[model samples]
Structure formats: C-alpha cells, structure tokens
Target: MKLYIKYMVSLRCKLLVRQELEKLGLHHISIELGMVEIKEEITEEQKQGLKSNLAASGLELLDDKKSILVDKIKSVIIEMIHYAEEIPKGNYSDYISEKLGYNYIYLSNLFSEVKGITIQHFIIKHKIEKAKELILYDELNLTEISYRLHYSSVAHLSNQFKKITGHSPSFYKKLGKKRKDTLENL
Candidate 1:
C-alpha cells in the first residue's frame, strides 16, 4: 500500500516515519518524501495507529487525490531547492509540468486553489530562503549567489530579497540572524 504523507519534507521526517512504521511492526518497501509504500496490507487498526503516530509528529496521511497531487508538487520543489546539486535548465513551469505530467496552468490553478498561494510565489519564497542560507554561510558573494540561483543580476536578487524579506541582501547578511522556516512550513 502506498501512503501519501503531508509535511514529510526533510530527512528527519523520513526517519520519523520509518521509526513509526517499525514501531508498528509494518514492513515498508520504501520511504520517500511525501510518500511511502508498505509491503503488506495493513489492518484498519494498524492504519489508524500509523495515522495517529504520524499526526503526533506533525504529519498527516493524505487520501484525497488533489491533496496528494499538491503534496507531490511540494516535494518536487523542495527536492529541487534543497537537494539537487545543479538547477535544471529550462523554465520552472515547464520543468514542473514535465515532471508532474500535467499542464502548467492546471498545476498552477490547483496549487493556488489548495494553498492560497501562487506556485511562482512559493518558488520565490523558497529561493529567498535559499538566498538567506547562502548569505549566512559566507561561502559565496551576492553575485555568485545570484548566478547560482539563476537570477539575472545581483541587483535583481537584491530587489527580490528586499521585497520578500524587507531587507536588502547586504543588510540581512550583516544582521546575522538565521531566521529560517522549516521546509514543511514553507
């Protein structure tokens, strides 16, 4: 049985889910962000127990198809931003559509309807969060960060950063505050 889970966006989440499954004595085939597959059919009691355990850890098992699709979209974006070494070449909408096997408009509309935020805004928010992380690491300058994130220029990055964060990249860096949202929350 394949279970789609919400808020399973990080390594810790995967571990937590694995632990819960083990505690329930359920054998899982695989555990991935936002989804898991179990080898054996589970009893209703086991399913309820698993759901309760997951909920205690701030995760929810999704049954609705739309909700599952939305979670899939989120997992893909989070993976691209936080794990992928190199940004894929091409427009994000095209990439997302191709990856999800759906039209970009349909995905965008579903995302907006479900999340109350546009997909573009979600990407921009995550990008800004990533920018903050890069700035704090002190590994790359603003120019390098911009180039790495596919921004047109440092000015463009700064402008977007300022718009979203209410602080310019330089100022935010100087502030030295590492205020970051969890991946699931974002």
Candidate 2:
C-alpha cells in the first residue's frame, strides 16, 4: 500500500514517519519525501492511529487525490530546490512537468489553484531562501550564490532578493553575521 504524507519535507520528518510506522507495526518498504510504500495493507485502526500520531507532529496523512497531487508537486519543488546538489539546467516548467509526468500547463494551473501562488513564484521564493542560506553560511559570495541558484547574474539575484526580503544580499549577510556574533557573545 502506498501512503502520501503532507508536510513531510525534511529528513527529520522522514525519521518521525518511520518511527510512527514502526510503532504501528507496519513495515514500510520505502519512504520518500512525500510518499511511502508499505509491505502490507493497514487496518482502519492502524491507519487512524498513524494519522493521529502524525497530525500531532504537524504532518498529515493525505487521501484526497487533488491534495495528494499538490503535495507531490510541492515535494518535487522542495527536493529540487533544497536537497539537490545543483539545480537542473533548462526551463523549470519542463523539468517539473517531466518529473511529475504531467503537462506543465496542468501542473501550473493546479498549483496556482491549490497554493494561491504560481509555481514560478514558488520556485523563486525557494531559490531566494536558498540564497539566504548560502549567504549566512559565509562560504559563497554573491556571484557564486547567484550562479548556484541559477540566477542570470548577481544583479538579477540582487533584484529578486531585495524584492522578496526587502534587503540587499550584502546587507542581509552583514545582518546575519552580526546576529550570529551577538549570539556567540551571549
């Protein structure tokens, strides 16, 4: 049996889900970002127990087809942006469509309807967040960060960073460093 989980985005979340499944005596054959395949079918009682346990931890066991598809879309985006070593080359729409085996237009429309934001906007938001993380790490300069996030140039990255965060990348880096320094002093 395959189960879809919502909000299971992080490694920590995977661990929690695994623990939950074990507690229910269910054997999971595989657990990916948003989907899990179990060795055997679960009884209603077991399903309820797992569902409530997951809910308490801020995750959800999804059943609705539309919701599942949306969660799958989100999982793909999160994996591509936050987990992948490098962003894929070429158009993001094509990448997403290819990954999900759906038409880009259909995915875009569904994503917008469910998420109240276009997939492009979502990707940009995640890319900027990744940029912030890289900046705070103090390893990559703006040019490197821009290239890592697939931005056309530092200028383009700077524009989007400022637009989304209301601060330039340099200023944000300085601010993050200062905050870290202050925390260390305390």
Candidate 3:
C-alpha cells in the first residue's frame, strides 16, 4: 500500500514516518519525500493510528486523490530546487509536466486552485530561497550563485532576488544566517 503525506518535506520527517511505521509493525518498501510504500496492506485501524500519530508530529496522511496529486507536485518542485545537483536546462513547465505525467495546463490550474499561488510564483520563491542559502554560505559570488541556480544572468538574478526578497543579494549576505527559512516552511 502506498501512502501520501503532506508536509513530509525533510529527512527528519522521513525518519519520523519510518519510526511510526515500525511502531505499527508495518513493513515499508520505500519512503521518499511525501510518500511511502508498505510491503503489506494496511488495515483501517492501523491507518487511523498512523494518521493520528503523524498529525501530532505536524504531518498529514493524505487520502483525497486531488490532494495526493497536489502533494506530488510539491514533492517534485521541492526535490528539484533543494536536492538536485543542477536545475534542468529546459523549460520548467516541460520538466514538471514530464515528471508528473500531467498536462502543464491542468497541473498549473490544479496547483493554483489548491495552493492559492501560481506555480511560477512557487518556483520563484523556492529559487530565491536557494539563492539566500548560497549567499549565506559565502562560498559563491553572486554571478556564480546565479549560474548555479540557472538564472539567465546576474542582472536577471538580482532583479528577481530583490523583487521576491525586498533586498539585494548583497544586503542578504550582510545580514547573514539570521534570515534563512527552512525548506519545509518554503
């Protein structure tokens, strides 16, 4: 049985889920961001127990089909921005559509309806968040950060960074580690 979880966006959440599964004697085949596959079918009582336990830990066990799709979209975007070695070089719309096996139009509409934010806005937010992390690390110059995040140019990156964050990247770097957001919150 496969289960979709909302707000399971970090390694910590994965560990918590695994622990809960073990407590219930559920053998899991795999646990990825926002999802888990168990080796055996789960009973209703087990599902309820797991759901309650997860809820107490600030995660949700998803059941609705639409909610599951939305969570999958979030998982893909999170993985792409935070975990991938490099952002793909093509249109993000094509990449997301291909990854999720849905038409871009449908996915965009569904994401907007469920998330109350356009998919583009979400992507920009995450990209800017990543830019902040790179800036704080102090290892990469603005130009390098721009290139690493696949921005068209430093000017383009600066423009979007200021637009989303209300400050230039340099200012953010000056402020340092005090302002970074966790990946789950983004």
Overall lDDT per candidate, in order of appearance: 0.91, 0.95, 0.94
Extract clashing residue pairs from model 1. none
Per-candidate total of colliding backbone pairs: 0, 0, 0
Model 1 deviation from the true structure expressed as Cα RMSD, one decimal place: 5.1
lDDT of candidate 3 over 23-73, digit per residue (tens): 999999999999999999999999999999999999999999999999999
| RMSD per model, one decimal | 5.1, 0.8, 4.6
Q: Which ten residues in a row have the lowest lDDT in candidate 1?
A: 177-186
What tens digits encode model 1's per-residue C-alpha lDDT throughout 1-186?
999999999999999999999999999999989999999998899889999999998999898999999999998888887778977768999989998999999999999999999999998888899999899998999999999888999999999999999999998987774344344356
Candidate with maximal lDDT: 2
Global lDDT for candidate 3?
Answer: 0.94
Judge candidate 2 at residue 24 and give its lDDT: 96
Q: For residues 13-57, what per-residue lDDT tens digits would candidate 2 score against the true structure? A: 999999999999999999999999999999999999999999999
Q: Which stretches of candidate 2 lie over 4 Å from their true place?
A: none
Question: How does each model score on TM-score?
Answer: 0.91, 0.98, 0.93
Off by over 4 Å in 3: 177-186
- Return the top candidate by TM-score: 2
Candidate 1 vs candidate 2: the TM-score winner is 2
